[model samples]
Target: MNKRISTILLSALFSVSAFAAPTSYSVDPTHTFAVASWSHFGFSTPTAVFAGAEGTITYDAEKPAQSDIAISVSIETVDTFVDKLTEEFLGEDWFNAAMYPKATFVSTKVVPKGDNKFAVTGDLTIKGTTKTVTMDATLNGMGEHPMSKKQAIGFDAETVIKRSDFGIDQYVPYVGDEITLRLTTEAQAK
Candidate 1:
């Protein structure tokens, strides 16, 4: 177990961003994850998380606006902490994972919001439905990793999407149609 944790940490270290020049970094599955949540029965909130979000991001400090990102998350990897719910999400009512297996985001513009924060606008495609979305991102930290002796960066980002718009609003107000996505990633210069 210790070894597994160590490996995950090391992989995430390589995903750190924010530094000098144009650098490309691959997301560390062990560290980066996409988490989504929505109100449940108008009384509570249930969340599902996805790991193995493999992708690459290119950051150019000199021209922040020119930075680009492309990320893909496998819908089959969702962990709702409940076996039945996980299965339900894969069925026809929700994600219909058998038919549409992946969710992807491609950034069209990166607008600096000042002080290591930016608004990343892009197209989010899910279940064959595409919609424009903007994620607010904050560069939490940047510099060098002591153990790896390499430049690294970390960031937090979030966005909200209405499931109904994506054609997955099965429950509507009862189960909540709005889902909030939270993301955290760390990678190294590549």
Candidate 2:
């Protein structure tokens, strides 16, 4: 190739690589999970664990506004500590798992709030109802995997939702309507 043509081609390739961001990453189910807790009877406390979920996370540190994430949680895998309690909670009175078998969250916007923080606005679907929820998220950081030497990014986020908003209005006077959720996602370069 001619010298000038070679230089221009090389420049274009370098720029494309610099701007090309990983578009998606498969969630490591073993490493990612959702933990949520709330008051039980205003005295006793309870927690449910969500397992058997799969999703993809799309992110670019330079283009936070274009970042996106989506996850699917299996309602049938909801664990509530006690069989009876878990069954009831997953039934029509709470999550209605019998009919609405899955919960999902999809990001609509990701805006930088400050200092490695972001305001993530998304739609959360529970019991077949979709509600817009905003959460505070942080890009915990990124680094190379010690074993794979691949790029990885860590993230953490928290959000609160009202169960009643999704028709889960049981034990009103006792159980707190406000439910808080915490999530952590570690994404590797693809």
Candidate 3:
């Protein structure tokens, strides 16, 4: 090819490649978790955690609003420190893990809430029910991983949802109808 034509093609390729790569990161499961707690008998109680979670988040600091997150948690992996209670939670009485093994959250909008904080609006699906939940989040900043040689970022988010709204209202006056959730995620570049 002629020199001028070759130059044009190279420039086009570079520009195309620039937008082709989206900075993505994986949730470091060891450093990440989703914890939910509810008041027991109208009093404070130990928290319950949903273990065995895996997910990914893609973001661009330049365009903060373009960020998106997808998270999945195995319902049966819940740890309430009570064997029979955990089993019952996974049964038809609670999460129904047999039929719906996982719960998911997908972001639809992200709004800044000041001081590295944000309001992440998304649809949280549990037990085949979908509810629009706003998760308060904060970008814990970015850093370079010495071992993996990948960029990593941290985030902390929280949201509260009423269990009765999602058809998980088995507890009634015993267990609070509201569930408070907190998510701490450390994502490593993929």
**Reference-based lDDT, each prediction:** 0.86, 0.83, 0.85
Q: Point out where model 1 deviates above 4 Å.
A: 1-20
Off by over 4 Å in 3: 1-22
Model 3 Cα lDDT, one tens digit per residue, 77-175: 798888878788888978899899988889999887677888999999999999999999999878797777789988989999998887899868688
Scanning candidate 2 in windows of ten residues, the lowest lDDT window is 22-31
- When sorted by lDDT, best at the front, the candidate numbers are 1, 3, 2
Task: Name the lDDT of candidate 1.
Answer: 0.86
Residues 1-190, model 1: lDDT tens digits: 9999999998777555333468787766677888999999988889999776878878877788999888878899989999999999989889988998888889999999898999999999989899999999998877787877777777788999999999898878899889998888877666
- Write the residue-wise lDDT of candidate 2 on 62-89 in tens digits: 6778889898778888888889988897
Pairs that clash in candidate 3? none
Supply the TM-score for candidate 3: 0.85
Q: State TM-scores per candidate.
A: 0.85, 0.83, 0.85
